[model samples]
Target: MSQVFKGCCAAFLYGVLLATSLGGLPASAGEGGLYRKAGGIEAYIGFVPAEITQGHAATQADKPMHDGVPRGHHQYHLVAAVFESDSGARISDAMVTAQVSGLALSGPRKAMDPMTIAGTTTYGAYFELPGADLYTIVLTIKRAGATKPVTLKFTYDHRNP
Candidate 1:
């Protein structure tokens, strides 16, 4: 009955609809082309060239938010859209972090910034790929009211892509 509750319901339904329509989309839709469903969550991830984020920075109204994107060689923009496995509700408020590692190389954990687009919120951040062999992208998601965090692992074979 409350406006807030109604709005959230609408958004949840929209997310469900979007998830259902995923089959029609190309696997390489976001250039990075990655999707996975595990631990009762469906994660759609895209890791592309960081240069694309420069365009986003130009459109940002806040100067501080613009510099959040890191710069480095073989850097890529990682965007992740996570949803409830059954309800299709988008989880926007979760604290998302991603760590990139391959072979003996590993980096510190970096928190993902929430980016809202068309009324939908997703998580993203910049990371180095270095054209390194196969890199494992491990995402740790912590949601409010949930006792344990959800972890998702994805493999990025930079050479093939």
Candidate 2:
């Protein structure tokens, strides 16, 4: 087989192994978290507090806030990953962005940064929450080789926090 095919197979196996080791699929799968397929690519999206992301980062350092976001605002990181739906191979070459809106608040669509954890590539962006309210997160993913972008929307309840 060709080297590219071999690589894809390896990546597929890695994804399966990782999922198994984690005990099951991500909670996002059941929580209205964005999981969709288009143009042969499957996208998985999630959001978490910036503090949680900082804790996960190997550097363990806080990220600087964007100039416009006010201090003390609740900050969150949007995380996304793409995979080949058929083969389960992870796709790292993609342009990802997200917009958040709710409670009369709307955030700019921010470009996501690619991050690798345990050999898996995930894209993320940071956005600020104005207060404890319900928010809708929209993710747009343009995967390499795909003709059109895929959009995923999900509601996040921040009222409790």
Candidate 3:
């Protein structure tokens, strides 16, 4: 206990055994929990209605739409999303874009392969609106430093569209 306090108590017990062996790892290694339940950059916009309207259900209320959308006075809104990051991490080469407005819709800003989520890299999209209400979605998600491409504006409500 004199060699410089035994080398400062062996470097404080080797930093508490390397922080308890990295806290026993496995919290998905890093950035865990599906990007804090889709409120992070991992992504989580939603939709999936094909029909219901006025009474609501044209996609955006419990994620309907695989058996009911596509009807009426023009109110499609069948968009879907669930993109999470850092699993296999490639997301079809990330350069995604979207800008949906309230509805009275058109097409294409994004529609990625029936909403992907295989293995783990998490990516999804299904945009197919023809009508609905309340929308200000604005996703970007590009790679290369990924500095300013995670903009979310969320406010979807196409009850029965």
Candidate 4:
């Protein structure tokens, strides 16, 4: 594709992702998911059962090796999508890390790997979120061009949500 076409296509996908993911919510006020805007970057945090990743691997054999679903503790798949708040451009190269704590216990601080989904790039990591407890997820995002990284927190109520 031409350079102009690729730029327009990327911009178009960014807009679509913003519209569908944010769903008109300006910041972190949504019931379906967590979306936070702070320090010039917008972030979304979510998690799914780890089995979903394994299921996909079994069904999709043609997927690229680089896009493999991350595997670790294999309990939950934590995902985060980050973007520049001003331009709505996806931050694919950012260094993303997360720490999950719940019930007075905390998991080891680890880096989240970058993954591409449906032509969009996001960060993900595997964690073991067991039981029906309220979990606090703290995310730290650092970009190469930025002098300081941004840190954000989100609460996930496994019992209620």
lDDT of 2 by residue, 74-111 (tens): 77766677676677777678888888887667768888
TM-score of 3: 0.24
Q: Which candidate number would show the highest TM-score if scored against the true structure?
A: 1
State the lDDT of candidate 4 residue by residue for 1-161, as single tens digits: 78666655654563455346533334334434477778988888877666445423221357532254456553776778888888877788899999988868876677887765656677777777767898888899999978999998888888754
- Local error of candidate 3 at residue 108 (angstroms): 22
Q: What Cα-based lDDT does every candidate model obtain?
A: 0.68, 0.62, 0.42, 0.70
Q: Quote model 4's TM-score.
A: 0.69
RMSD of each: 10.3, 11.0, 20.8, 8.9
Q: Compare the candidates by lDDT and give the number of the best one.
A: 4
Q: State the weakest 10-residue window (summed lDDT) of model 4.
A: 51-60
If the candidates were sorted by their lDDT against the true structure, best first, what order would they fall in? 4, 1, 2, 3
Evaluation by lDDT, superior candidate among 1 and 4? 4
Q: What is the lDDT for 47 in model 4?
A: 74
Give each model a TM-score.
0.71, 0.65, 0.24, 0.69
> What's model 2's TM-score?
0.65
- With a 3 Å backbone cut-off (N, CA, C), the pairs that clash in candidate 4 are none
Q: What is the lDDT of residue 5 in candidate 3?
A: 66
How many residue pairs clash (N, CA or C atoms closer than 3 angstroms) in each of the candidate models, in the order given? Answer: 0, 0, 19, 0
